[model samples]
Target chain A: MERKLQERKVNNIVCRCEEVTEQEIRDAIRKFNLTTVDEVKRLTRAGMGLCQGRTCGSLMEKILSEEINKKVSELLPLKKRPPVRPIKIKLLAKKERESE
Target chain B: MNKTADVTVVGGGVIGCSIAYYLAKKGADVIVVEKNKGPSFGASGTNQGACPLQLFEPPVLELARQSLKLYKNLSEEIGYDIEYDNVGALVCSVDEKQYSDMKKHVEKKKKQGINVRLIEREELLKLEPTLGENVVVGVEEWESCGVNPFKVNYGFACAARRLGARFLFSTEVGKIEKDKDKVTSVATDKGKIITNFLVNAAGAWSPQIGKMLGLVIPVKPRRGQIIVTEPTPLNKRWRCISDADYLLTTAFDLKATEVSKDKRIKLGVAGVYLQESTGNWTIGSSRDFADYNTNVTMQTIRYIAKRAIKFIPKLKDVSCIRTFAGLRPFCYVDGLPILSKVDNPQNFVIATGHAGEGITLAPITGKLISELIVENKTSLPIDAFSFSRFKNAYLQNLG
Candidate 1:
């Protein structure tokens, strides 16, 4: 069973939100010589979906570290911006009004 | 590292990458030094990618026009898909005062031979039904377009690399050594690179590079927050839409305190809606003087959301997936970029201080700076953007 798993191609989906495959992430890192998650995100749209890299960020980092032959500690995590989760514009607007 | 190059461009943002590409294309030994891990990690990667030609006047307009023309064939020239879409842009007015203001502005633009026309509410709505009922008037600039900012930055870097330009990432430029008045070498954390010419294309960090040479570059970091909405079905063709106030306020350099007591105006909240090729809408933006801070405040995000909703109305239902901020390299001295060869540092050239228009002006900035270096003269007159103009201002501010 372990040998069969090893033989299987890297076809597993890394970022479900963007439907980015593991092979796609690995290829982008190798082709672009990417060292950062942000660069990979811009090139392949792996971490730019609704989840915003929350799910696939570490998976991508692992792939990046392996491709670049660098320590996982050396690779910076994906940048986290505001709106941790998707929120309706109406919610933000309502919050502003309530504050006012 | 090459250790020696004909030219060393600091900052691997769009400006630096573009300059490197142009310089390398001219057969000059070029080296790009970036403090970040990759290209476009700065403001170049964070902008909304709107090329609004109707926003400028005179010499600056000439640069914008030239840039727009170059963008038409840039994807093929660079052999990379920059996603340059010439879909045009709409500058809509939400009030009667703004409507009258736009009418006069449109007339001036028409006289200047810009392909722009003022449209009434009916025509404006027909063009963009997503706009709210408050939209009284709009000006359609047919020449304006939007490109993928990331792709454009990467395209230039990749093309330059293909053309034999050396890019040194994760490298911070330390000291710039000079022989008399001419630049001799640049000291980076990596090593000393001996180069005859140096181009400062550091975007918001231009002032720091200027400081290294004992020069005061009047560039400050002006924070602009932006919100990105989830992909939604568009009823009509995608067009870059912006509020008239955004252009007017930026053009006039209206102080937030002077404009109104309203918090939104104080925060410099302006609506600029752009739907990327991915169908996700990138909404923005709010401007504030936040020295090198790229953090998006909850208040600013809410204010931007409110302003966007005020313009599109349907945006109220759209979910905001993310919000981010970028610091524009705001040049306080005359609000124009100082793209000039400095007299003191003879071999040193300054090609920055493009605040919000970096994306729009990247190609022209690259071409003109390359011309200044290779040909020692430009195809178009750049005397207006010289550093000598800021000598008196810098002295006065220092005193």
Candidate 2:
């Protein structure tokens, strides 16, 4: 019998944007021994979505910070890039061809 | 290392990841934050992967077109196989009423400069012989495409990271500490992180994110239920099929539960999406009033499975193994998303309400958002999707 499956560990929200529960994030964090938020993002999409981290990033940082007893700034905010939304492949191709 | 990014993105969904990818490709110091293990786990992960430019609303259609083009070569550019399938889409009609509706829909689709065509039973059968014998006519858009939603999200995330972008996961925002209308810094569950600008990609959580800045982003959850069957030996060239009215899968009727107890009655062809690699065919989805919860109901599973089997009897041997649901964040009335700046506080840039199209509109949405933050010039015209449009009714009464 899968005892872990049978165990009723109550679920809680650790990341609200994606609706990822605390037990789940904690499990990943503990299992992975994650340190930075970026590692957590790769492991889990906790801060990804529309509200972005406007609502949940700090809370997750706190959860991890409290668990490890570190300042949030030590972890640092995540990075950003270009093409903030979905786009056309043809546009990219056109630009590529133009450059060549 | 006290490094500051050109911009800070809150969500790691396809929308957020795409934006990050673009900025990084342009040599912008980009940061993305995710709450789950990775991007595409929420609405981005669960919705259909239709990149259909033919069916989108006008302005959105333009964005969809650009997104479609990006998707065509994203696999090569992003260095990942997103499982793009331009095998075409079919809308099988069961009755004359639907046939007539489809005829009109096809006519309009052509007038809109789309390449959709109507096919009779013979052509439909030639296209998909395993289709139920009853399927009479179908609307086929040969150029329409489908993608792996999870892969799309992952591709953007991975591509963004490769381009010198950083992402923070398993972290939550505690407060948007603001100075007057300008955001000074963001406090996390751990500590404070300062930034020059904030992009709201919280999906269903957009409303709460706005509340932090004394702004109101009207976003709510529209739930969709899905059922998956055991893998079958389905061909790769096969297309995704649905009813012309398959779009109505979002609305659920709790009263119909009694009728479904006895016989398999398909309300409409609402749920339709497929995985090109997996034989586990996904079928009939319901749009329910249920909020943020990811619970699976037997009633919904039965109705969807039964209708899918009815549409294609080959499913009898392929027993259903799992049923799941996802939430789409939508703006109440305006079909457009909230992708504009807000008043009162300047640190927040809103980007929500992509609805079921988040997977499709992601790339363009991210592009436009980055332009707004970095160069302050949107590559595409998005006047119809501005956040200030709701000022008359919503922003005035924000909680």
Candidate 3:
């Protein structure tokens, strides 16, 4: 996966599960005024596409804290919703439709 | 290190979680204490996610309108898909009386800036052909929308947690420690935590929590049951459908015992139907003041199914997968939601009593509460939902 990421030609892939690159994260930071892992996840879908941030959360936070010139604790973590594992949208939709 | 916080929010439901999220975002040291292990453990987890403007008066309409605007960006902002679909809603009128009443109601709502119009039976059928033949007229609100309630609750909670908000789940607030008409700390089943401010968003249990402070909230539990159908094909164009009389069942004076008995006789069953993205249809619901009993009865479920079938005859063949019940925290004082700070308690804020619209009004509730705590005032005028509105009732109950 690391070799494949280096060979991607355009940039260094940081989050292998989400195929997110360091350049993309930096671009999202500048473009969206992102200062935390949470903001990066929302704008670039860096830690949300796959792995639910298990692989790239710390990396993203380190990059964010460095970019914002803030301590690690100052930057917020990525927000996580239920069903951390991938579930079919059909099931979630079915559950949400009902008014119980 | 002791677990001290700037604000301690009671209840892990949507309202509490949203308030916590906004407060944390505003840089307040927040702690949420919930008896349940996670958020949306109450009525916030249940109910169809309808945010219709026509169903509310001025006070609620203002909040609902603002919340709708916030929901448009909530999914993106929170890094979660709340599935907010602005499909609109239809209020079907089955008789002449209902038709005229609906017409007047639409006019009133229109005056309040709601984008609603009265449609003829032909137009209504054109919009939703599956509607029953008894429907004479319909009032359609084009701006109405639905969302995933659970996602909304969890989204707010997760965002709040990410922003350094501490969540103490499965820790019941056994006692409230106050100092001379001011909130000082909260004693939970796990341990005692000190706090500067307190927020009561305990859904059905808000009144019970208020008893610890000698406050009367006038909120009660209204039990509403719903039924979920299997993956059945529904018209994507069709919006949420509702019988015109759903609001009448939530009257303050109507006791649950009396309404439950009369509903069995006349069965003034109004159907509320919404199709999910999964090709399943959710139909409901029956309301009564069941006093925190969140049990789904076979009788009520059967009645809801029959009534839904009356609205859309196509649902007659769909098999119901399951049934569930949720308790709506209905406040009896002027039928408005309570969102105010008590006079006696210096740092105590009450943000419950939203009833059925809790899901719809949560965003504004959070914004208002955070603004009150952080800025010492609210951007929105919350005079109508003031705690003083129920002061007379609270005094009478005390007597």
Question: Using Cα atoms with residue i matched to residue i, what is each candidate's TM-score against the true structure?
Answer: 0.95, 0.74, 0.78
Q: What stretches of model 2 exceed 4 Å from their correct place?
A: A1-100, B1-3, B235-237, B248-269, B273-275, B395-399
User: Which residue pairs clash within candidate 3?
Assistant: A99-B48
Model 3: CA > 4 A from native: A1-100, B248-269, B394-399
> For residues B1-399, could you state the per-residue lDDT of candidate 3 as single tens digits?
457999999998989999999999999999999887566668987687777667777777889999888888999888878889876888776767776678788879888988888889988777778887878888888677788887788789878888999988778998898889899889988888899999999988999899999887888887777766655666745668877766434333345335465553233345578886756666766666678778776566667766676677777766565556788888865557899899878899999988878988998899999999999999999988888887777678789
lDDT of 2 by residue, B207-321 (tens): 8778877776767887776755545677534557775445322222324422453333332225464634445566656655467877765555555655665557666565444
Q: Write the per-residue lDDT of candidate 2 for residues A1-100, one digit (tens) a residue.
A: 4666445332666567466776777765675456656546545656654344556777778777866678887765654322234222222112223332
CAPRI tier of model 1: medium
Better of 1 and 2 by DockQ: 1
**Each candidate's root-mean-square deviation in Å?**
2.1, 13.9, 9.1
* Stretch of 10 with least lDDT, candidate 1 chain B: B250-259
**lDDT: which candidate is best?**
1
- How far residue B83's Cα lies from its native spot in candidate 3, in Å, is 1.0
Compare the candidates by TM-score and give the number of the best one: 1
Please state the CAPRI-style docking class of candidate 3. incorrect
TM-score of 2: 0.74
Interface RMSD in angstroms for candidate 1 = 1.1
Query: Comparing candidate 1 with candidate 2, which one achieves the higher TM-score?
Result: 1
In the range B293-391, model 1's lDDT, one tens digit per residue, is 899999988888877887889989989988899988888777788899998899999998888889999999999999999999999899989999988
lDDT of each: 0.86, 0.68, 0.77
